[model samples]
Target: MSNLPTPAEIIAKANAELNQAYRALGDARDWLLSDWDVQPTAEQAATIRRMREAIGTAKDAINEGRP
Candidate 1:
């Protein structure tokens, strides 16, 4: 018998991967914001804000479009 994954299994795997990516982004965000004793410089703060927005956009896309 064939052992190939079914469509549902493939989709489940993809969703799991996407969740992992989202988690990694969160971890990076936490590290950038809290892992250091010193505050980020203005440029660094701006970049972090951009990164946060991007993560929020990704979350919205995942919530709105995921199967």
Candidate 2:
């Protein structure tokens, strides 16, 4: 058993991690909207906004070289 990852394995792991992060952003957005009436703290609002922006940037990078 070696500790090194093959190129394919590394790519797969990176893709999976990006997918999970995207999904988490979606979940956070949904929760924020659904619970807006509860008046989330300013810190919570800022955190959600940051998460959404980070996800957008990641998506942009992924799409950059595509046609």
Candidate 3:
């Protein structure tokens, strides 16, 4: 048998990795907003917003037609 993953397995792995990344992004956003004590500069805030939007788009793509 070939040891390669099937398409379902590949999609599952991608979904799992994206979830981990989303969690990490949340942690970083929280730290920047609260734990760091110092306020994020305007540029930093904009970057965070962009990251959030990008992650949201990724989620939509991965979950496009699942039950």
Candidate 4:
């Protein structure tokens, strides 16, 4: 029979996912910041910054194994 993952293993998986999410969010922000014919509005830029911050918060929680 296959052994189930322990709590530590589960947290590790969640942390990996959170790290990926953070990276993806950062990539999006970078793309937004890149030069383009049309640029994001002030509000749009602010929203992207907020989204990145939220992703950072999630990464922190996952590292801490918060419920």
Candidate 5:
């Protein structure tokens, strides 16, 4: 009990983690595009954009009720 986080604290931590993961994914994608010379086709670009958007949306959904 002493070591347990409150519900709000747990939600805050989870949201922070999710945001970090999303940023990491975006950074990886940027590195591939800029440093690794990625050349995605139109469809591939769309797919990547959608995936990024989905990651953000999921994070928002998860953090909806927390402070």
Candidate 6:
């Protein structure tokens, strides 16, 4: 077994992982906002905002081929 991955294979894997992470963050943000008042801490809102910005930045990188 080898530890190294081909460039194409690495790119494919990274893209898939990034897409999944972005989707999960979006889902979490949606869930938080839908029931924001139930939370007793500001952490959830802060986290959702940060995740939204991160997703936007990730999408931009993917689109710009800078990732």
Candidate with the greatest lDDT versus the true structure: 1
Question: Which tens-of-lDDT digit does each residue in 10-42 have in candidate 1?
Answer: 999988888887788778767666766787899
* Two-way TM-score contest, 4 vs 6, winner: 4
Per-residue lDDT of model 4, residues 1-67, tens digit only? 7599989999788778877776776687677567868778999889877877776776676557643
TM-score each candidate.
0.73, 0.54, 0.55, 0.56, 0.50, 0.51
Model 2 over residues 1-67: C-alpha lDDT tens digits?
9899998888888877767766776677676557455776899879878877876786676556332
lDDT of 3 by residue, 1-67 (tens): 9999999998788878767776776676565456556667999889867876776675576457342
- Give the lDDT of residue 15 in candidate 6: 78
lDDT value for model 4:
0.74
TM-score of 4: 0.56
lDDT of 5 by residue, 1-67 (tens): 4988998898889878867776776676565456436678899789877877776676566557435
Which residue pairs overlap in candidate 1's backbone?
none
C-alpha RMSD values across all candidates: 2.0, 4.3, 3.5, 3.6, 4.0, 4.2
lDDT of each: 0.81, 0.71, 0.70, 0.74, 0.70, 0.71
Which ranges in model 6 have alpha carbons more than 4 Å from their true place?
A: 1-3, 35-67
Candidate 3 least-lDDT 10 residues: 58-67
Regions of candidate 1 where Cα sits further than 4 Å from its true position = 1-3
Which scores higher on TM-score, 2 or 4?
4
